[model samples]
Target: MGELKLMKGNEVIAEAAIRCGCDGYFGYPITPQSEIMEYLALREPWKETGMVFLQAESEVAAINMIYGGASCGKRVMTTSSSPGMSLMMEGLSYIAGAELPCVIVNIVRGGPGLGTIQPSQADYNQATKGGGHGDYQSIVLAPATVQEMYDFVELSFDLAFKYRIPAIILSDGVIGQMMEKVTLGEFKPRWTAEQIEQMSGSWATTGMKGRKMNVTTSLRLQSEDLEKHNNNLQAKYRTIEKEEVRFDEYMTDDAEYILVAYGSSARICHKTVELAREKGLKVGLLRPITVWPYPTKRLQELAQKAKGMMAVEMSAGQMFIDLKLAVNGKTPVEYYGRMGGMVPSPSEVLGALEKQLIGGANNE
Candidate 1:
């Protein structure tokens, strides 16, 4: 075990990055997520762990800095809110195209041109469907609690390096601002240059060092070469889909109806599950931890037995599309959401489920 302490979600992200042996953090400050960089600035891990922390002038600069660091096989990361993320999209595409391994955290707020500083999950489509232009995908992890907010940073780094791709921690303002007790993981020493060379020797642009000069770029002027590169990328994505789908289920054994959700909304829906069960409503909850490599297989199986499913979100039904596809029309799917930075309570969610799924089905 390690140190146990109560900390805010953004603070733990900074501490967890340090403990996970991250080489550097390059990010700009944005509302609902500015605390992440603020915490790092206050902690000043440069003196403690030799970690590099830079407050970039803009989100664009931060993401490009990530590209440079990751090219050297360093564990680099960046965090931002919705507008800031919009600024980073092109850089994100470049990083993905170059196949660099780095972690990016998006503590999402209400969107569509600075909608609100409060929480919203509207970025669900943006994160899972590759906000950047191209056929690439990032491993998108949705953390529902403060503990998960800390734990997923390390997991995101692990998966990013393992697959040689960018990984994203897709969180919302609620989780980012919440505080909870977390058991800190044991500190890990930053990797030495020699260790980086040994681990990433295959393609990392460390140096010539008596070998062929390594080149890392996404440019393939030749159409044939670009197509071949895309094929390789697709193959990698398939492997990830096969191995990385992660989700959690509650009270699903004899569930007649199901609720699908992620991130902060999932937390509310958990209580909704308990409340429904109290009313003798056989309702279960499916929370997708990784929203990109979604739990489609499990949802498909559940669809065969479930009378209906309702997707609860903080957006105007973005993830609802994925849920409908996952069930493949085997069962009726409904959507309930609150937009413009509004968060629905557990009772409200249960009421939506009752009105949209249960009562509607009974009427039929």
Candidate 2:
């Protein structure tokens, strides 16, 4: 084993980015996510390893800075909260349209115009459906715990670079601030020069006089060409759905009732599973790591074995819709959550599960 340390998820993200040979970080300070920037400033990875950390004037500027760094074939990332993430949507669309490879972490707080400083999963629809104006998709990776924050970031970097697309670590405030024992493996970068070159060769702004400047843009003058570009992006997304769906199964091998959750809520659901187990309830957890790709297939498979699932979240069951779709009316799928930073406790979830398990309440 490398080492074990109790650290917050935000701190681990900064360290992990540096260890992954991140060349730059461009971000605007935001609530519940400021610690990541503060941690990077104190650690000063830039001083030791030439890594650049730039606190931009705003989130828009920050994401554009990410675009600039990525243009140079450098591994770059940014971190912010929900409000800040909203500000970056325009740039996010541009980055996606230009086919750039970069990582963005949104330590989400309550949403819809500065809602709260506490944790929230309200950004699920925005993240999965593309908050920007254009038809774009961000590879959204959700981490359920501080440990997964570290583990998933490494994977996020790989996916971002692999797909020549902007990838997001769609985490929340609780996971960012919570301290947990984390094990980091040997530092190994997911990208090689050849890999970077391949991505850049596809769309990056390398040079001009060489080959008509190789415009990095998402615009096409002809409708047919624009349609072609959109079609290509859609195909890439389909590829991700096939290869990038990730989730965790617990007590699910023989589960009669399944709990569908993601991010920190799913971590809470795990404890709920333990309590349900002692009470002789056949419960299990399906924790989706990629919120956008949404492990619908795996959950559908579980639906075949379980009576139903209760979608858990810090928001008002924002993910329940996906669960219902996966279940396809074959089983009951309900909702259990609190909005504006109110997280359900293990006892609260247990009570809800008990009500459903006994009463068969399908609250839609």
Candidate 3:
């Protein structure tokens, strides 16, 4: 344990980045997530940890900077909101295509186009289903609490490097601005040049030290080569889907009705579970921690036991499609959401559960 401290979710991410021995951070200021860069700038980790913190002129530049650092086999990251993340889609696709390991945090706000600076889960489709122009996938982690926001930073780095792929911390304003007590983890030293060479020298651009130069590019001009690359990427994605599906099942052992959610929506659904339980309803909450891999196996298993399921979210049911596919007509699955920066309260969720799942409205 490093220390126990009260902190906001965004600030915790910054602190954890430094503690995790992150080599570089490049980002533009955005609402609900500006605290990440602000804290890093204030702490000046460069002086103590030899970390490089640079504020890019735009999100476009920031993600490209991450590309540059990650090509050199350095642990790099960036943070942004919904609109800013949109701007980074091109770079994100390139990073995925090149198989660079880096973390990108999106403290999501409501948006189709700069909609609002309030919390939202509308980016579910964008985040999980290739936000960029490629047949690629990024590992997406959704944190429901401040502690998770801190912990996921380290976890994201590890998974990113292990898989040689981009990892995204898909959070929202509700969690980003919320405060909580968190126990920090021990500091891990940054990777040395020798270690980088040993680990990623085959692909990473360390240098031409006694070997051929390493090239990191997403360009595959030839059709046969591009097809081969796509096949390899697809295989990796399948492996990730098999090995990395993570979720938290709350009171689901004998649940009759299940509620599926992630991020802040999961936190709210937890309370809704309690409220429904008090009303003698057998409702459980399935909170997906890894939104990309999506706990589909668990959902399929639960479909066998539960009568039906409900997808609760801060969006207009983006994740509902996955739930429907997971259930596969075995049991009914309905969607209940509050979009455009509106967060559904416990009472509202309970009401929806009663009307949609338990009250025979969806029984037919």
State the lDDT of candidate 2 residue by residue for 244-312, as single tens digits.
998888899999999888888888999999999999988899899888898989887888878888898
Best by TM-score: 3
Cα TM-score of candidate 3: 0.99
Give the C-alpha lDDT of model 3.
Answer: 0.95
Across residues 139-227, which tens digit of lDDT does each residue of candidate 1 receive? 99999988898899999999999999999999989999999998899989999989998999777899989678888899999999999
Candidate 3 clash pair list: none
Model 3: weakest 10-residue lDDT segment is 355-364
| lDDT of every predicted structure (CA atoms) | 0.93, 0.85, 0.95
On lDDT, the leading prediction is 3
Give residue 265's lDDT in candidate 1 (0 to 100). 94
Which residue pairs show collisions in model 2? none
Instruction: State the lDDT of candidate 3 residue by residue for 1-364, as single tens digits.
Output: 4699999999999999999999999999999899999999999999988999999999999999999999999999999999999999999999999999999999999988989999999999999998999899999999999999999999999999999999999999999999999989988888899999998899889888978999999999999999999999999999999999889989999899999999999999999999989989999999999999989998999999899899999998899998998889889999999989999999999999899879889953
The clash count of every prediction, one per candidate, is 0, 0, 0
